[model samples]
Target: MPKVVLLFTGKRKSGKDYVVSKLKEMLKPEDCSIIRLSAPLKKQYSIEHNLDYDRLLDSSPYKEAHRLQMIQWGERKRESDPGYFCRLATEEEDKPVWLVSDCRRLSDVEYFKSHCSTGPAHPSCVLVRVSASDEVRRSRGWGWVGGVDDGPSECALDEVSCDYHVINNGIDEQLDMKLKELKNFIEYNNNG
Candidate 1:
């Protein structure tokens, strides 16, 4: 069967992990497997930077500043490699449905475009974006107080351009509804 990957993104504490976990539960063991790409980068970075993994994960720089470091390192490791995230996603060929959490940039989108197979005849790819107000995001544990257009400053301006947008305003029930909608959307569009 062709694979279906749900590419999700949001600012830190925008409930990206929570939403992805919800989808994992909804999809179940047989329906899909949830794969997180940032884990590998987090681990490697923790080791190199001498920072606690859990502590660094919640840091805004972890996604922005460290992501650049990771990309540069990955480029040296392999000249066309899109970094550890894409590499990991490609390794998960056995799963029919994949929930790809934490997509961050246009490069990440293009990496998925090149790595994922999508068509009317195949399972396809679904890109869903999650967002929240700066207040809500900060309240939910977003590391940085100010949003930035680039680099490690918590909020990135381009997140609105993702394929599907979900506003996570810190309400669990609302988040659930949006995720359910996403699940239905994917099934409906990829059923062929």
Candidate 2:
């Protein structure tokens, strides 16, 4: 178990990765590392579809072209095992602080709450909701897809409880303040 598990959820292109990237720069390497719940999904999907996993992980046309299908495939996988990707993402992490960068559904949050938070290490698990305007997301390359934008994967945690609510609009004053608040949470929770 980690000293803190910072679980983050946000809509597509809401700057979830960007916020965590900023956190990575703020925190020392030995103190924190990012874990993406989508990494395992993309790895498996690439194998099944004979696609390059590297390309799938990149921000290229190939990834955008298959984003919807990959989302559907991941949904099916989650239906069978809600914690599959969540487990894969964290099982190997030994850092004292884990920034889980892509928590989409409520189950993702629940998984950490049930497993990591209760271990002998007594990890501090907390939800963080990252938000940005739809216009900002569109500008960041997230065009609306009828089924996915309407689906459970995107909407499951829209109203869920969170310890921090951050508005990431390109690292403005508001974002800096919110990030400091989050750092306070981590600084309080970190083991050393």
Candidate 3:
């Protein structure tokens, strides 16, 4: 089990990936790992659809074109097994600190809390919500898509309480401070 598991959730273009990347940099590379749940999902989708798995992982038009369908496919898999993707994401993670860069549902949180957050070896799971105004996201190339934006994958955790709330609106100083606080929290928990 990891010493700390940081589960992050946010809307598209809300900088969840960016913030997690920065957080990873703050910690020693060998001690931390960024786990994306979508990677496995996309890989499976790509294989079944005969699409390019690498292209589906990026934030490009190719990914956007298949986003809704991919979400639906993932949802169906989750319906049968809620922890399907969660298990795949963390199966091989051995780092003491796990930064789950994209946690889209309550099931994802439950999976980590139930599986990884238990025992004396690890601290409780931390849920961090990275958020930005729609305007800011739009400026970052996010445009509302009907089924994709309004779907469960995007809205499942909208009202879920989080351990930390990060407002990423292009304010470097503020973001840095929050991230530092988070890094400190992780260190404290790990050492305790």
User: How much lDDT does each candidate structure score?
Assistant: 0.65, 0.86, 0.93
- Residue lDDT tens for model 3, 139-170: 99999999988989899999999989999999
List the candidate numbers ranked by TM-score, top first: 3, 2, 1
Candidate 1, run of 10 with poorest lDDT? 145-154
Q: Best by TM-score, which number?
A: 3
For every candidate in turn, the CA RMSD to the true structure comes to: 4.2, 2.2, 1.6
lDDT of 2 by residue, 83-168 (tens): 99998887788998899998988889888888768554544888899999988998888888887887877898988988789998
lDDT of 1 by residue, 88-150 (tens): 655755666778777765556666666675654653776787778979877865455322434
**TM-score per candidate, in order?**
0.73, 0.92, 0.96
* Order of candidate numbers by lDDT, starting with the best: 3, 2, 1
Candidate 2 regions exceeding 4 Å error are: 118-123
Decide which is better by lDDT, 1 or 3: 3
Clashing pairs in 3: none
